[model samples]
Target: MVAGLLGAVGGGWLVTRMRLFPALLLLGLCQALVNLGYIWLVHSGPNVGVMAAVVSAEYFFSGLGSTAFVVLVTALCNVRYSATQFALLSALAAVGRVFLGPIAAWLVPQVGWSEFFVITALSALPGLLLVVALRGAIDRAERARVH
Candidate 1:
């Protein structure tokens, strides 16, 4: 709960201070770091402090990352098709979670906790790359919204 609240606060700050793509990139990076923290938590072995810190970081980043996603979705929606588009995008996000669960479960045992989380953490890279790749488009869209 505390971590979530922190993430909410961080996300709100990001929304106000930065453009959508930059904010999403930052949030995505934070998410990847948080996954690394998970590997540390798993290896630390019975250390409550490590567990708390990792869980907190995880919750904070995940919530903030989710908020970024929602913001991006909102930015992308066309008013004419917003209802359906938003629903579809949001559902796809939910499906992503579902899809990852089994993959994570299966991989964790096969590759070990550290490697699994590392792979999961690195998964953020593609989106970050896309953000960079589509910077011009994102900027134009935001500019269009303003003017």
Candidate 2:
């Protein structure tokens, strides 16, 4: 909880000051890499300190990534349809959260924890690719808002 709180607040502040792409890319990358920490904990065996640290780091990065994602979504919204678009986009974003659980459950047993985490980390690539593709659009939108 403390990690989450710190990440959310700190990330929000930091991201607000950053250029859009850098902030989003950094947060997304960090979030992806953080999942690998769990792989270490699993192999290292049960140590309460490591478990707490890994969980905290996960929460921290998740909070940061969530903030970055919201910023991207909000930045891309049209003012005329801001509410509806934001709602729709937000719901679309939750699709993975809604479906990935059962998928992960099935996957974990098949690949084991270490490989599962590697796959999880790699899954961030598609989103990062989208961010790259949308960079121009996001810049245009921000420009529209400012001017």
Candidate 3:
């Protein structure tokens, strides 16, 4: 876990410095694979049902937290206001921690491990779709600048 976090930080820095889309894409793919691996590991252990429930609750709230952060940050940003935008983004990140533990505890008994991770993995599809849809706009923006 520590290594993964450190690697994420390093990957983010590298992406920023290199301004490389493929690197970011690879990092995102790696994160998904890692998450899937974690789910597989949990399911393979004893108490599969309990583990599934716990992981499900953990990731559900995590998704909510991530969504809230993204929305709040996007709303606060002025396109021209970088500093204040990012600061507000940082503050909103704390909202996730408040319910993370309790949610996990509450969810474990209700859902099994395999289904929980599978659902979480499926939730990522919407974001992927959004990126796909935006590809055309991104290409247009790039093309416009070339002229």
Question: What TM-score does each of the candidates earn?
Answer: 0.89, 0.93, 0.50
Best by lDDT: 2
Q: Who wins the TM-score comparison?
A: 2
Error of 2 at 123 (Å): 0.7
Clashing pairs in 3: 52-113
**Model with the higher TM-score, candidate 2 or 3:** 2
List per-candidate RMSD values in Å.
1.6, 1.3, 7.8
Please report how far candidate 3 places residue 72 from its true position, in Å: 15
lDDT comparison, 1 vs 2, better candidate:
2
User: Which lDDT tens digits does candidate 2 get at residues 1-147?
Assistant: 999988888789977798778888899999999999999998989899999999999999988988878877887898899999999999999999889989999999999999999999999999999888988887786667667
Residues 13-90, candidate 1: write the lDDT tens digits: 787788877888888898887888987888889999999998888998888988877777777889799899999999
Better of 1 and 3 by TM-score: 1
User: Which parts of model 3 have CA positions greater than 4 angstroms off?
Assistant: 1-5, 13-20, 44-80, 89-108, 136-147
- What lDDT does each candidate get? 0.84, 0.89, 0.50
Misplaced by over 4 Å in model 2 are none
Deviation in Å, model 3, residue 129 alpha carbon: 1.6
Compare candidates 1 and 2 on TM-score and give the better one: 2
